[model samples]
Target: MTAAKRQFHADVFITLKRLVNDPEGIEIRNGLHNLGYDDVSEVRAGKYMQLQVEAANEDEALASVNEMCERLLCNTVIEEFRVSILEPQAT
Candidate 1:
């Protein structure tokens, strides 16, 4: 991205392959139980990524990030994501 004017931030999530057993989740729940937090039953882990973008406006920034996600970052099949918009940073 060019260091000119607009900026965009993305908070992304990539879920684990469902076929793999969720041992981490089990461990978290077990640990919580040992800590007396018995109400907590399940905890699953996922991936998170943050990105900053440079563009003319929110529309361009979004399109750029969306393209990035589709082409590079996200799997688009197994992984699902949520995106966030941040104020543009001027250079």
Candidate 2:
């Protein structure tokens, strides 16, 4: 008998490279400064995604999430991504 696939939760974080200028982040910082929060020097905005994956094992789930990030989740040229895989949950 074959083992059943397990469920994995993946968290993806996408952000722009330091060399890249973030217009939105700058606007946010400007707004903060206007509100009397001048201590805020810089702000960098990013994206966070939570995904539930079905796989036979943790490694498989990780690979799948990585591929998803490389393919569609993130812009590899100007942006970078990080993935965190949680332990399998009870069925």
Best by lDDT: 2
Question: How many residue pairs clash per model?
Answer: 0, 0
Q: Residues 1-91, candidate 1, lDDT per residue (tens digit)? A: 6655666776666665676567777898899999999998677777788887777788777777777778888777666556666776545
Candidate 1 segments exceeding 4 Å error: 1-4, 16-21, 89-91
Superposed by TM-score, candidate 2 places the C-alpha of residue 35 at a distance from the truth, in angstroms, of 1.4
Instruction: List, residue by residue over 1-91, the lDDT tens digit for candidate 2.
Output: 8778988999999999989999999999999999999999999999999999998888889899999999999999999999999998766
Error of 1 at 35 (Å): 2.3
Highest-TM-score candidate: 2
For each of the candidates, the C-alpha root-mean-square deviation to the true structure, in angstroms, is: 3.8, 1.3
Clashing pairs in 1: none
lDDT of each: 0.73, 0.94
Give Cα distance to truth, residue 33, candidate 2, Å.
Answer: 1.0
